[model samples]
Target: MHRVIAKLAGLTLLMLSALPSRAEEARQFRLSVPAEVAESGLMDYLLPRFALKTSRRAELVGGGAADAVISADPQAGTAVMARAGTVYALRLTGENAAARRFADWLSSDVGQRTIAAFEPEQGAPFAAARQQQAGPAPALDGDPALGREVALRHCARCHRTHDDDRSSGIGSTPSFPALRALPDWADRFTAFYVLNPHPAFLRVEGISPPFDPTRPPAIIPVELTLEEAEALMAYAASVAPADLGAEIVHQ
Candidate 1:
């Protein structure tokens, strides 16, 4: 029994010693994205969130030195059934632990949802590692009128809430009607607040429409409960054009 315990302790020490010894490398996590995709603003939104969730300091690398690389399935075009996206862990230097944690998180429900929510201008929803049918839609219990009121009060400053009520929102932000026009808008709305960019930019005290440059920036995204999100979806749907065309998913 004593011999077995001694052997186990030696084995443990051997494994620890085998691990990479660069303290700086262990503290830094690096991810590489395809160049075209990197330019779409999606990775800008996602990579920071990845670091935040996994408690790591992540850096984006050009192509190599990546703890993980985000790539499309090579057989996607040729194979009838191919993965939507694949994450490759390079096990570079001393980043194995950080790499594994980020990869695991990417496959989690929250991570997959966030990944799918980012509709990059250059591509479609990401092929998540764990692909599952979306869960049942959240109940829309709040009043549509109340939802519109909420939008006018909170979202109008940044998003175009109505066709007539334009020229008020941030120039770059999408109009609510435009967003609802998408075929999968319903699903997208379900996870919007929990996804990147939204998580970073939304504030509880929604800035008023017509930019006031003088006010100090507010923290916390325009606060909307699940109930409010449901109502907002309903209101946006009501205003959306009946014949809005299908949007193409970028490859």
Candidate 2:
């Protein structure tokens, strides 16, 4: 067990030495791969590219003490990626930031393209599993009326709730309509409580942990029940998106 850890650590240092520029800031994690993958030199081919793009490094290791794993079948943890049929895919064991970034890159179009491009001396390149057509997401469950009330009491201080709500909310911050216009509006609304500015002063009862006493909120805390937070999302979803036209090209 100690020998395996030492081997991975030594390899990590060697890899870091090759990239002196990012070595200091690099986040290193272990990724356990099947023997086939290791023998194929996929990590040797993929890791350098991933590290160059993300500045995070993975030290290839065997089973145990790994932050992530490459598997043909995942029994647990987040399934990151896999190829069609015979051996494929990387899986995460936890919410490691570096691991997530690696997963993101692996799932990205570039990542898929890179995977398809890799050709071992003796075998065919791995291909992505065929994805099924996804249907529209269901509308979030909550009371829009109550959500509006919550928004007016809390969010309205920073965001314009309606087109006519110019008198309220800070000018620098975006309006609800404008935010709803964004591509990731749903993600933004649903996870806003964890996003910046909100975390400092906002709390969702039974969901968010209590604020640290040593670093108390800058302003009087604004607390909400989980129901209120869900309702706020419902209201935001109901808002009409502002018309943000085509991108301006600088030719």
lDDT of 1 by residue, 1-251 (tens): 99999999999999999988766465567777666557767667766887776656667885557766665433221111011222222223333677667666666667666765676664334434232222223444557897898789887878888888856799888787777766656545554543334434442222112222453336434666556767876776677654556767899
Put down candidate 2 lDDT per residue, 93-146, tens digits, no spaces: 876778778888887767766765776654334543212111122236699999
Deviation in angstroms for 76 in model 2?
12
TM-score of each: 0.43, 0.51
Alpha-carbon error at 236 in model 1, in Å?
1.7
Q: Tell me the whole-model lDDT of each prediction, alpha carbons only.
A: 0.57, 0.71
Give me the runs in candidate 1 sitting further than 4 Å from their true place. Answer: 1-137, 201-221, 242-251
Question: Candidate 2: where are CA atoms >4 Å away?
Answer: 1-139
Residue pairs in candidate 2 whose N, alpha carbon or C atoms collide under 3 angstroms: 81-89
* Number of the top-ranking candidate, with TM-score as the measure: 2
Model 2 lDDT vs. the true structure? Answer: 0.71
